[model samples]
Target: MKYLVMVQGTQLDYEAMRGKASPHSPAWSEQDVQAMYAHMEAINNDLSETGELVDAQGLAEPAKIRTVTLGDDGKAVITDGPYSETKELMAGYWVLECESLERVTEIADRVTRCPQPEGAPNHPVAIRPIQDGAGDLC
Candidate 1:
């Protein structure tokens, strides 16, 4: 079966507090983000070689985000990106063809183990089984 794995956004105040001199852990920096990308690329390359990677890509900045939504009036609302009203935003996602949920869980485990910037928050990969034939109607 094919499954989708994506990062879940964290809370806004939790995301906003990170800084260089954070009384605690610092927020993600450009270098931190770059390193994260490198880690993702490495994982993707390995997955591709193992024939586990169905497809995956890094997400763009939230400010450049866009999406379609429905309003109370039932009107189609073409609005800005990401629905998360918090600081933590989806970084990217992956669609993997796996033998079982356990297999995908292992993949998520490895990804969550990735070294992240300080105060990067928890790594929560949401997994969902993709329904087939639904696209046929599309």
Candidate 2:
């Protein structure tokens, strides 16, 4: 089955990495960030070697996002965003072709342990199976 693993974190987490300051801990040293990336890269390499990783990528900061909605006049209304209403944001995702949800969960568990700044809370990775049949759409 193909599954998507959505990596979630708060806006503050992104800002902390960018500004070298974390709300949950002291400023992140350059080495700390590098180490984190190294850990993540190792995971990616493992997954790729196993032929389970389909794709993976991180997103730009939330502030760079734009929200578009249809206005009363039926025109598109665009707004800048950090999506202040929400505390959590999707930071990245991985698409994997795996044997089962159980296997995917195991992978997610590993991701939850990836290095981050001290005091940072463990974030959840939302995992869902991709629909493969027309019946699934209904």
The lDDT for every candidate, in the order shown, is 0.73, 0.84
Q: For model 2, how does the per-residue alpha-carbon lDDT over 15-130 read when each residue is reduced to its tens digit? A: 67765565565566677779879978998999999999999999987877899989999999899986568777889999999998999999999888887767766778899889
Q: For each candidate, what TM-score against the reference? A: 0.71, 0.91
Cα deviation of 58, candidate 2, in Å: 0.6
Stretches of candidate 2 off by over 4 Å are: 22-25
Give per-residue CA lDDT, model 1, range 27-95, as digits (tens).
Answer: 766676577668888889988998989999766556667788888999999977567654566667999
The stretch of ten residues in a row with the least summed lDDT in candidate 1 is 12-21
| lDDT computed for candidate 2 | 0.84
The C-alpha stretches of model 1 lying farther than 4 A from their native spots are: 10-25, 29-31, 70-75, 81-89, 134-138
Root-mean-square deviation of every model: 4.5, 1.6
Backbone clash count, each prediction separately? 2, 0
Query: Best candidate, lDDT-wise?
Result: 2
* Best by the TM-score measure: 2
